[model samples]
Target: MIIDYGATPPIEELSIGDGSHLANYRRVYASSEKAAARGEVDLDQWFRDCDAAGIGKTVIKARDVETTFGGRISNEEVAEVVARHPDRFIGFAGVDPNKGMTALRELEHAVTELGLKGLNVQCFENRLAPDDRRMYPLYAKCIELDIPVNIHVGINFSLKSSPEFGRPETLDRVLCDFPELRVCASPPGWPWVQELLAVAWRHPNLWIGLVAIRPRLMTVDHSGYGPLLQYGRTILKDRMIAGTAWPMQPMGRVIEEIRALPVDADIADLWLGGNAQRFLGM
Candidate 1:
């Protein structure tokens, strides 16, 4: 039951642009002439690769940032893919908080009509902080729907927005306001790792996803993740889950790297998949 908590749905076409989130993936396909030539992902091949990596399931997420990012992928597109491979994939809905009530209705429609399991908020892409007032309605909707909220909770490299938008302290505000909101902070709130850990420790409903980060770095003394590694293997073992952020890091490599970290066997099991299973309600 190895579950990958962060991943984009397979795409047939992906064009590179300054605002495109997938632009970072260009480095990933640099070696594959076929991928570079077609500029598209081979859906079936990606599933085969996940199989080779021992990934039993992955959550498919979309990003809705048409204002800053130029375009948006619909929740319907993600839901359709999940429909085809329901056993292998779960879908998360992305709605632009800037749209206010329209966005709220979209989220309700996504979860109730489209069957998406969670909501995803890329605050940096939207140029909003985690505690931004615009995000509150969506958070409230998630609580009402009883679905989890997955947020980008770390420094984002894209110069298109301010890095401060991802500061982990903002999450504490959200948690305080919505005490019961099930939240998963992705990228493990890096650079602010300790802040995120403290928040998670205080909020039982919050989770951290190791997405787009090299797991092995956690054990490298000055990596700043040392305390996180230690705590994860001890008291916070159930609060962490693995997320490869596919195309940024290969699935097989991410799993193997986490396994090689100096953590106990039980902690490894939880981080690898068990925690995600519980978070995703599997």
Candidate 2:
């Protein structure tokens, strides 16, 4: 089965409240729309598009930034969709780290009560390093719940926070502390690709999701992603997961480009879907 590991469902509106955070997303949405208009995407349309692209299931993610820029897509919102289309969608919950124990309770409620599958941590949005102690509680909660975590682990372009916050090196400490935690470092940790590879090689539970990045660019000579592409097809074949980062790139186009990559059928299958299934324990 083809599973998309990370994707924002075609929600008519995302509540990214006012400020630089909201503005940054506005820019992201605007740039993304250049590839495919938002008017053409809706929940059911999203399912049809995924089907056309051979995507059997999609994990819908939501982000909460109440402590920072003031925005949220509550657990209830994501669970509603997954409840409506249980077969086609999986829900990942986002909790504001600043909420402390409250966030932990919410996460437990999300997985146990709401039936969410995993956790989504936008490290940069939280303005905390991936290894920040403030996030340790949440990590512990996820481990206790036996759900994987998808964390932003690369440079973030938003002006609201330092790009260093998303460094892949930070994850090393997190992995060291929580060796059994299933973590997917999103965006492939570009510019620090080798560092991430080493970390992933050291931690069997770590996975990489190619989100907000086109597979075609990974093969380009000077794209800075060439090494990642090489390792993904070879040594790290089972550690890679495909994600369209929809709106950033059209789902159909992303799938087509990935199919065109110079990799063996087995490697492609693992990268495209098998790895995600294994990571999520589906």
Candidate 3:
């Protein structure tokens, strides 16, 4: 639905590392190569198409791909724009959790100085998972700040050597350990939507989101998750949201992709901008 669980910023707007290029990874090589070859990498065109398609707002990450958020917008850059166009965007800080205290401090910068509403953390990139006890310190800071964390779920764009970090179930431990923290699981809900719904039902704060990752409702086998889709109809109708991943895909394609889904006007309203409006608190 139109919810924020910490998704990345517009990658097209970001350079490969100055916060654009991500860490050293093999899959990243393939992904980057593919992106470069695509050549449909203009940022404004993507935003324009989304706006034309009636897509509401986008969540941009402060640091992603960048080893230290290299070229594009830093938390400062994001803060400046969000402060100016607060209605159009929501800022989330992406940090290397492996950096320990520095990661937490960067998060503080996102919240205290940049005024970000939440975080989009790459658990796989940091050599950690949501369940890692060593990372509890970061979660502690999030709880104190009242911000939600969106972990990269499903197949990672940058590709990870280890899949353990991407498991939705790993978060079960985090949910049980810290009941107060709000976390959003993005994509396929892989493993199981029932498990996700069950977990969310158990804890009011846990959530699931679709951040330019496509929707399950559009392609579900419908045998198991039929009811969820039924209940999610409200969100499906009013809260559908999309992210182009910028240079990865043409912005027009993202809008077409949503339009291609089986959802009707009600769901279209949500996925386009309604949900984001609510999630970003716009």
Candidate 4:
């Protein structure tokens, strides 16, 4: 069963507005031309593509950047999708650390009351570092709730915030503080790929998510992503997770590329789905 670790479905709540913070993102990484032209995603077509690609389950995440950027994809909306299609989708809650105690309460509500399975945080978008003091409480709460947290660990294209907010090394302190927290650092931590691999190697609870990034790049020489293929087949084999981060890339193309990566059948299975199964506790 293949599980997409990160994705933005065609939910109206997930729509990107005409905001300055997302100007760069809108131009550079938002690849779905048709969706852009329509100012929305075609939900039916997205599901059809996932089905055609053999993606059994896709994790839809809510984003609550209200405090910093006035953007939010409510947890209720994500829960609604999961409620309607439990077998095909998983919901991850988004809570702004800037909300303080309210964020903690919202997280609990999302999991205990709303039935969401995990948490998603975009450090750069939130304008906070992963190791920032404000994020510590949320990390602790994830441990208490027993859910994994997917943190954006690589560069964020948004011109509003500095990419330094997402430097992979910042996660080192978080891992040291919350060793038991199941953290998935996503987009393969490009430019600092080796640093992320080292951090993941050091922390058994950390998982590397190949989201938003094209799998084919991992095979190219001197791409800096080569170590993921090398260590992913060996020491990091059991902790690598795959995702389409759809709307950024076609799901079928991402899946096909993952299947084509040069790795043993067992290792490929782990990257495609096996590791995600274990990570999500499916």
Candidate lDDT values, in order? 0.82, 0.85, 0.58, 0.87
Sliding window of 10 residues with minimal summed lDDT for model 2: 12-21
lDDT of 3 at 38: 47
Better of 3 and 4 by lDDT: 4
Could you give candidate 2's per-residue lDDT for residues 122-224 as a string of tens digits?
8888898999999999888889999999999887878888889888889999999999899999988878888999899888889999888888988898888
Which residue runs of candidate 3 sit more than 4 Å off their true CA positions? 1-13, 18-38, 64-73, 80-87, 157-160, 191-198, 220-231, 234-242, 252-264
| Per-residue lDDT of candidate 4, residues 1-282 (tens digit) | 788888777767666444678777667765543332233547887788788989999988888999889888889988988888888898999999999999999999999999998999989989999999999999999999999999999888887899898899999999999999999999889889999999999999999999988888889998888999999999999999999878777788888888898888888788889998888777
Per-prediction TM-score to the true structure, in the order listed: 0.91, 0.94, 0.72, 0.95
Q: What is the lDDT ranking, best to worst?
A: 4, 2, 1, 3
TM-score: model 4 vs. ground truth = 0.95
Question: What RMSD does model 4 have?
Answer: 1.9
Model 4 ranges with Cα > 4 A deviation: 30-41
User: Which has the higher TM-score value, candidate number 1 or candidate number 2?
Assistant: 2
lDDT digits (tens) for residues 173-275 of candidate 1 = 9999999898999988878999999999888999999887778888787988777788888888998989877666567778888888888788888998899
